[model samples]
Target: MNVGFRVHQDVLRPDRALLEGFAGAAVGNLSDAMHGLYTMDSGIRPVVTPAARVTGPAVTVAVSPGDGLMLREAIGLARPGDVLVVNAFGATDRAVLGGTVLLAARDRGVAGLVVDGAVRDLDEIASLSLPVAARAVTPRSGTSTAGWGEVNVPVACGGVVVQPGDVVAADGDGIVVVPADQAAAVLAAHREVEAAKGRPSDLASGGEARRSRADVVFHRTRAAMAERGATVVPAAYHRWPVPPGPTAASRPDRA
Candidate 1:
């Protein structure tokens, strides 16, 4: 079986602080923070949120269907600020993204997309305002019916593995799969990343280091607990979203 698609290797990655700075930590917290986030799951039904573009906490899709036509139907359902995530159900060599589909995604206000397999329309997908990231490009296209499949269901994709509604972040550095269970923590992590990194940046800007020994202890404790697979440490001290620079992130009050 063939799957996946083509995309720009020069894609851009959003700031990890930007991804983790959201104060809203629930399902509806980043309701409007819809700009980025993508999954590499195959047969995903990516629906674009009709709301304004959000910069953080973008819930991605993972579909494990065998049908390629329904996949296109899912793309039709997307609104705006959405990055369509598709998994070709173990088909990485087939072309799922082509000129026509890329145009449709763009016309529907979709912002971007990611696939773990291959794509056919290279020049056109690149030209659209919608950003696409994938593994390879091919001269092939998806079969109207590759047999059977489902939409909106959880499916494993890419190297990290993913499920529907899991938050995804993609950029030039590649894509990060944020589990739905970890969304709040991941979203919360960005703040610390920004703050931790910001401490250095502030000093670089001739500002003082506001962090204290207590803060160091806090991170150390969290890191220790996390290393043991405990929930005591948040993503801030664990991994990703790393520590931010002194500048930190610019976020509006979510409350």
Candidate 2:
């Protein structure tokens, strides 16, 4: 299938400035930002470097049985800076991406793809050096390639709202959604986090305790536990360790 498109970098205007770069700030950490990050259930490991930048707004597709074929047309509709995001409705084992569809995106220079389902053609897609994010990898191909989709629609990739023109950033850590309004703010927050992180990791680990403050909470906790026949100890007093065994109340014969 032949696809055609070109994007002027000036028109897209992706932020390429060098900032207080943190190692993993560009993409939101899943642990802290679970609502925004979509986890791919992939075993084939689509590891991409940060240099794989995104430029366009998102072109969201909610895929059904015959929707896989719309990818070719999606690429045709997408300009250089667009990301093709697919909602597969949890059909992760069957491949939603293939060699043919990938060629269409690569040829048109679409930035990348994010799918909430499975994708195949690993070796071939990798050879083309396409940036793709998906749930898993499988040998299974979509049953049909017929067009069944809506253009410029909103789709959910694990609760993250992907709309047309939203910036989708993803790397090994995970994918993060930045609504057009917050894209610049997220970037600013990223720079601040990186700046703070520059302080030695050891410094954060060092002197993390106030012996007096901990003693109060520990003693209070221990006293409460002891009332219920349980033993507790604070790390500050290593010698007074809590005993590990069934207490008198735990043994019926003793009662």
Winner by lDDT = 2
Put down candidate 1 lDDT per residue, 66-117, tens digits, no spaces.
2456456656666455556666644656776677878887787766676656
Model 1, 235: alpha-carbon shift in Å? Answer: 41
Clashes by residue pair, model 2: 41-135, 42-135, 42-136, 56-81, 57-165
* Backbone steric clashes in candidate 2, count: 5
Candidate 2 lDDT for residue 145: 72
TM-score of 1: 0.54
Ten residues in sequence with the least summed lDDT for candidate 1: 45-54
Every model's TM-score: 0.54, 0.62
* lDDT: worst 10-residue window of model 2: 1-10
All-Cα superposition RMSD per candidate? 19.1, 9.1
